[model samples]
Target: MSDGLPMRVPAPGLPARVRIHEVGPRDGLQNEPGTVPTEVKAEFIRRLAGAGLGTVEATSFVHPKWVPQLADAERLYPLVSGLDVRLPVLVPNERGLERALALGAREVAVFASATESFSRANLNRTVDEALAMFEPVVARAKAEGLAVRGYLSMCFGDPWEGPVPLAQVVRVTRRLADLGCDELSLGDTIGVATPGHVTALLTALDEAGLPASRLAVHFHDTYGQALANTLAALQHGVTTVDASAGGLGGCPYAKSATGNLATEDLVWMLHGLGIETGVDLGRLTATSVWMAEELGRPSPSRTVRALSHKE
Candidate 1:
């Protein structure tokens, strides 16, 4: 846990606390068409931390040509370095990793796709070729004492190749674990995953020796199944979940992909279920409202919409 936040002991059926890995700042803003000023981005991250999100993904170190929105990674990291939260940046390759380390980043995440079509489209390489690229990145980060997170995109279905096979997902997940990823985040990139798919994939991973504790679920709300898929993961003992504040992200590579599961929505459900998340829902909703103003739009979060009316 970042900043030594106390973790609750999970009960028999459900985890007492679920660590919400907030990715709004990085994954959320990366797909925006217009530029968000560096100062505004910094303040947004500060507000997220203030709302008690301990593990917030601050920015991506990908080259400016690929993700121009996060081109200020060097400038942005220093601004939030003093915060008592786990600020993880995304590193796509060794060069990306070098940039992050230069900024004194303590944790970084690498992404790969499960299908060849998406890999070719997103990373400009085949699935095997991308993993070959990530191998050294993960190994080097681990050697440098930085926590490394592995992201497997399109774990359930792909836009180009529909209905990805279960075997392929498990194979890629196990390979990431073998390559020394501290944790693997399974992504439903197009939001096509149902609860049954979530349960089966998780069960397959466990059978392959990659336990649920080493996994996190990243779901998109395109088909309105993000929350339901998340529930399936929770029932199967997955404790880490990836969500965006105000439902702020979409996939640039996969145009059909939509916003991520809203942080406010996830927190509301956890609180109702008597699960501990250490997040202040009122504060989270306020932050979302503030960010919506910055983006010049209303937040996509249902919880934010409903709560803003009361406020």
Candidate 2:
């Protein structure tokens, strides 16, 4: 309390360290109404890495027509590529993959949907069709010696489809894993998941031969259950968590989507639980606050607000 830090109480049966997959640059800015300048985005990535986020998603290679906010992926990646961290980019298909590969991206992620409705809405392809599209992208990335991550959105619920079945999620995840994805990020895209749902999904994944080691969790905060679902994931042995700085990003395709779990908030909880993330809390909070100013709004992260106001 004296140092303005949460009292550490190490949680039992939790990983001692969690790798936060910072998604602010790519996922966070994709839905922004205004264009964030390429230099500003490069600076954001620099600040995130300076704050000790080891794995930062630099940008996406999606067509500018689809995500104008990140249209400068070509420019942004070059600016931050020199930073000493793992920089991943999302590739929608072989074209996107080639764009990232041309820029020398070492790690690439492909986005998929666990529900038919989301698949059709987001990718303009059915669930099976979308997977077919990503098949070669993942294969090409792996063949090039690049690490591939599969992002499975709507694993918990879909805006159009309501509750997604456990079996449906497992099937998609298994196929992604089978397609040479090094890791799979299970996304509660609409922020509708609870602790119990998280537990059941993880258990099913485990039973289906997809262990927690190759899994990550991405939760939105539409219902304020992001942290609780995250805690459940930690208890279940999933170490990688996808978070956006300052609680940024929402699904532009999903009508009910909201901001993601903020990096500051997730860092606060992890540090409070005595889990090592290697992130400098003060520096990370400052980074978020700086980013909020760039975006012309206050940070939605409770921890960012609390810590910044305390100063």
Please name the candidate that would achieve the greatest TM-score relative to the true structure: 2
lDDT score at residue 56, model 2, on the 0-100 scale: 97
lDDT of 2: 0.93
The alpha-carbon deviation from the true structure for residue 1 of candidate 2, after best TM-score superposition, in angstroms, is: 2.6
lDDT of 1 at 176: 88
Local distance difference test values of all predictions, in order: 0.92, 0.93
Off by over 4 Å in 2: none
Candidate 2 residue lDDT tens string, 174-237? 9999999999999999899999999999999999999999999999999999999999999999
**Count of clashes, each model:** 0, 0
